[model samples]
Every structure is written in structure tokens, then in C-alpha cells.
Target: MATKEFDELALDGTNYPIRASNIKINFASRGILNTIEEPNDGDPEIEPRKLNTALFLLRLYIHKDLKHEYMLETSPLNLWKALKERYDQQKELIWPEANYEWVHLRLQDFKTMAEYNHAVHNICSKLKFCEQEPTEAKKIEKTLSTMLPEDRILTQQYRTNNFQKHSLLIHTLTQAERHHELSLKNAQQRPPGSAPLPEVHFNVQNNAKNKKGFKGNSSNNPKNLTGKRKRNNNRRKFKDRKKGKGKDKAPQPRSNGNKHCNMCGSDTHVAKDCRIPKHLVLLYQKSLKDKKSSENPRFEAHFNLTHEERLEVASSHQAPVELESNINVLPEDVAPLSAMDDMFIEYCSTDPLGDLQ
Candidate 1:
């Protein structure tokens, strides 16, 4: 290998090390030189000074920190999409100017730490939007007083590229504040004695049979005038007597065995309890049954209907019939059909077999 030193060069101020190794520069066969040179060995890592210089240049390029300001003004939803795209394209490596500006702008300038953190995260949440930030995240922790815990973690995740932004911090805060205010207002507006414990009112009617006494209620003591079993029996006897059944022949309650239909909530009936006429019920039963049996069911309930209600439903359902009786025969002396009518009739009459000949 032959090395061309800077001292040998005519007069260029900067020193340039020219490589002229046994490995020939293939300028002829393939058009461009794509192979790596031994000196600048194409290692993945760059020198610290060079890296620092690149960072400085990147910082300078994003001078105004427009990315940060934009985040503060724009919605978190918009900032996230831009950040993810910039990060994925290796903008941080290839075009640091664009990358830093994109992230910084979206992250910084948030009015609240929560807003700032949330904005940062929304940008990083590409793979999984539901991703969360580490508990020990720094930025949110620094501004703990102003920033919500979730927002702090979210910001750290986005800034460090660990988690995707799942929820908007601003919205969550707003909703929480609203709920709190509503609760406070409700608490204040409530009546002082609102919802007081329920009380039962007792009604007493003096039968005037004797002096003021516990006429209806029973006493536990056998010596008391009214006893529990006796009181109950007396009430039953009074009810039977009021019903006008024979005094000795005890009155019995009705045993119709009719029960309300659970399906339609109709009184003491199944679908058969529907107010639809018996003939219509029979006609439509198959359709109703088939529909009910299917996944999507449409069962109609018709409770016992008043005469007016029955008439209304029947009238609504009945198709309008064009009655010949309602048709008024125009008097010949009144208004006669114009000449156009005769022409129309003649035209229509021409097709006799087309009509009811």
C-alpha cells in the first residue's frame, strides 16, 4: 500500500490521507466504488467527536424548536402520526434535523406537563397504541405536581420510544375535572334532609264498640282482649261478610288457574292471549312460531283491549277499500266531460282485446 501524505500535496490547507493499497481501485469494470476502504473501515460506530459534531449540527438545524411549539398548538392525535413516521425512516440517523425537530416540536411547549408528555407518546405509539410507559419514567415524574401519573409514564414511553400513546391525557383530565365538578354540584344542591329514612303510617278506626282500646292489633298475652289468631280470624270473617257470602258458609277465593304470560307480559295468557281475532291468530300462528323459533324473534303482545282500543287497532290494520257506493255519478246536466275525454276513450277502446273485451 502507498500512502499519500498531506505534506506532499501542493497547497490544500486541510490534510487528506489518500489510500493507494495493493487492493486496486476498480474504476473500470463496475462504474462506482462500493467496497469499503481499509483505513475508514466502515465500522457501525462513528468517532465520539464526529457524533458530537453531528448532534450539534442537528441541534442548530432545529433552531427555533418549531417541533416543540407545534406540539403545544396542535392536537395530540396529529402529532403522533408525524413522530412515528419520522422515527421509522431513520430520520434520526440520516436527517437528524428533521427527526429532532419532529420529536422536539411535538413534545415540547405543551401548556401542561401532561399535555407535553401525552404529545410525545402519541408519536411513538406505532406498533401498539395500547403500550404503556415505565413506572420510573423521568419527565412526568419531574413535573409530578402538574402532570398526571399516566401522562408522565406515557411521555417517558414516547420520549424513550418504549410505548405507544394509548389515551389522550388532556381528554382524561378534562373528563375527570368535569366529573368532579358534577359530583360537587350534586352534593351541594341536594336538600339537607333529602332521602330521610322511610316511615310507616298507621291508621286506626275506633269501632265505638267499647272504650279506646287496641281494637285491631293483637297482644301477646292470653289475658289481653284481642289475640293474634283471633284478630286474624275476625278480619277474615269481616271480609267474607262484606262479600255477602253466607255467614256460616265461608267465602273461598277464585281458583281460575290463569297465569300471566311471561313471554309477552300479558295477563293470564300465552301467545293465545293476544287480542288478535281467533281466526287471525290461527292463520298467523305458524309465521309467529317460525319467527320465534329463529334466532331473531318478533313476538307481539296484545293485552285485553278496551272497545275503543280494539277499534283503533283494527281500523289501522284494515286496508282501505275503494267502495263503489262512495263513487259519485256526475249528473249529466252538471259538468260534461271535455272533448279530450272522448279522444282518450276512443284511443283506449281501440285496444278491445287488451282490455276486458
Candidate 2:
């Protein structure tokens, strides 16, 4: 047991000297503690020897400065007592103010439960060493009071539950912390809005009707429909000019007396001798027809010409019949009028034509 006590004191190093009173008490309980005075003849020197051995071990472990000052003493027990009193006086004088402040003021400043628990444990150990340890309830109360505002509800709940054990309170707070972390993670993962996007449905029937109306209008619209007819007429006129099949074969000079071509509005020739392409002339005629077809009574009366006159105008723009030709027109190139009508309908259906209007 003495050997074990010496080993334990060795582990404490020089900084924490073993108490002289504790050593004496342990030795007395073992019936080995005694004074170091010389004994009578035939008395066993065992107690004195043990005291010398303890003193030697103590001197070996103590700091060099302490040994130089206290090692000269003849009585090992008195030496031990003196060292203890000196060190205890030093401790009482130099106990740090910061440590006391932390016990009272800074305990609550720990950010995490682990940190707070570790600090509280250390404080409790120090207080226990001084024989002044606080109760577990006080420790729990201090911990709950110092917690962050976010844990206020949990703190209140724990208080309401009136938890009897400090371990239970700590376990509950840690679990609450984990739950709070999980809830924050879930909130971050979710999208901001609760409302979903609206569904859109196209009215196929109404679209089909609108498409048909647009097709009909595009097919019957004189402006766009007569373009091919005018081009055909222009081709015929060009052929006639090349063949010199008109009334005036020679190049005509520009007429100086305001004799503009009625078909093309040029001050060069009469309407009959105008050099305008036959297609253009036909377009002009279609424009005139459209004007006559309008709601004007004067234009309607002007269009009331004899059948022979109408026949003469039609014959003037007619294409010369081709006897034979090498160029074969592909069926794909010459799309049927009905197909063209459908193309215009599809275009009008897809595009909003209000801007054009």
C-alpha cells in the first residue's frame, strides 16, 4: 500500500505535491507512522526506516528549488508538513480571478452542449476538490438558462417536464438540437412556392373553323389570286412582241403630247401599244374589275359594256397556243390551287395576322 501511494504521487509530478496530512493519515492507518527520534536499545528501527524512505522519494520527485530549501531537515515528517503549508499558502494567495469569473459569468457563453458540458464538468471537479460541489439540479438550471434563444421552447418544455436527472436533461437537449438541424435541412430542400402551374388547352374546333375562313378569303382575294394569272398574261405578251405579231412592229418614239400608256402610266405610247408586260396589264385590268364590282353606282354603270367589247379586251391579252414543247412541267412545281389554298390556311392559323390588318 505504501509502494502504491508512492507510485501515485510520482504520477502527479512536482507541480501537485501530495498532502503531508494525507500521507500521515494513510501511514497511521497502516500502523507504520511514527516519530524520527532515536529509539532505545533493542527497539526495531522499521518505522524510522519507513519515514526515511518516504522522505527520500519525496525529495526525488519535488522540484530542485524546493529540495534545496527543505531537504536539510532531519525529521522527514516535519519537512513534509512545512512543504505542504508553504504550497497551500501560495495556492490560497494565487487562485486565479478568471477561474472564479468563468464559474459565475462565462459558463453560459459556451456555444454547444458538448462545450458547455465539458466546462461544467471541469468546474464541478475543481469545486469537489475544494469540498464545495453544487447539486446536479443547480448544474441543470445553469445549463438551461445559458442556452441560445432558438432553444427557448425546448428549454421551457424540459422545465415543464420537471426532469429529475441531469443526464436526462442533457440527453433531451442534444436530441432537440439534432431535430432542429434536420428541420432546417428539410426547409432548405423544399421549393419556395406552394402553388402549381396552370394547365393550357387549345380549342381545336374553333381553330379549324378560323383556318377554313382564312383559306376561303385567301383563295378569293383578288390581290393575291390574280398574280399567277397576270404572270401568264405577261408571258404571252412577251412572246407576241418577239414574234412581231402586233399592229406596230417598229419601235415607237415617246409621244410628247401627254399620250401616256393607260395600262402602265408612261408617257410613251397608247394603251394598245404599251410595252408593259401582259401580266402587269392583266393585273391593272383586275384592279379595274375590282373597282367596278365595288358598291359605287358610277363604277357599276361604267362596267356595263357590250359583250363584243368584253370579248375584244379578253382576246387582246390571251396567250398564243403552244404547238409542242420540250420543257415538261413537274406536278410538284405546279401545286394544285386547292393545295395553295390549304397552305395559306395553315399559315393564317399559326400566325396572328392582326398586325397585318
List TM-score per model, in order. 0.18, 0.38
lDDT per residue for candidate 2 within 1-357, as digits (tens), equals 235444222222333423444565665675556542335789866666677776765565456777777758867667666666666543443345324843574434866667767777766654554456678888778777776688688678878998777778877777876898898887777576655444454477667777675655556788667887898899998998788755875666756776867797667777787778889988988888888866453323333232322354432233435657756655666876666664645333321333322
Model 1 ranges off by over 4 Å = 1-120, 124-189, 192-357
Put down candidate 1 lDDT per residue, 1-357, tens digits, no spaces: 433221221122011111111112322133222222223556454345543432332222221553454435233223323333433343223344333433345333465436655554544332122232233343333333344455677456534643223244345545755787898887887677697544443232333433365445334446454566777899998996798855566456443457654344445455555565666555566666787778563344543222322354332233334568836787667656674465545234433235323
Q: Once model 1 is optimally superposed onto the true structure by TM-score, how far is the C-alpha of residue 174 displaced, in angstroms?
A: 9.4
Taking all chains together, the TM-score of candidate 2 against the true structure is 0.38
lDDT of each: 0.41, 0.62
Cα displacement (Å) at residue 344, model 1? 99
lDDT of 2 at 22: 54
RMSD of 1: 34.7
Error of 1 at 246 (Å): 12
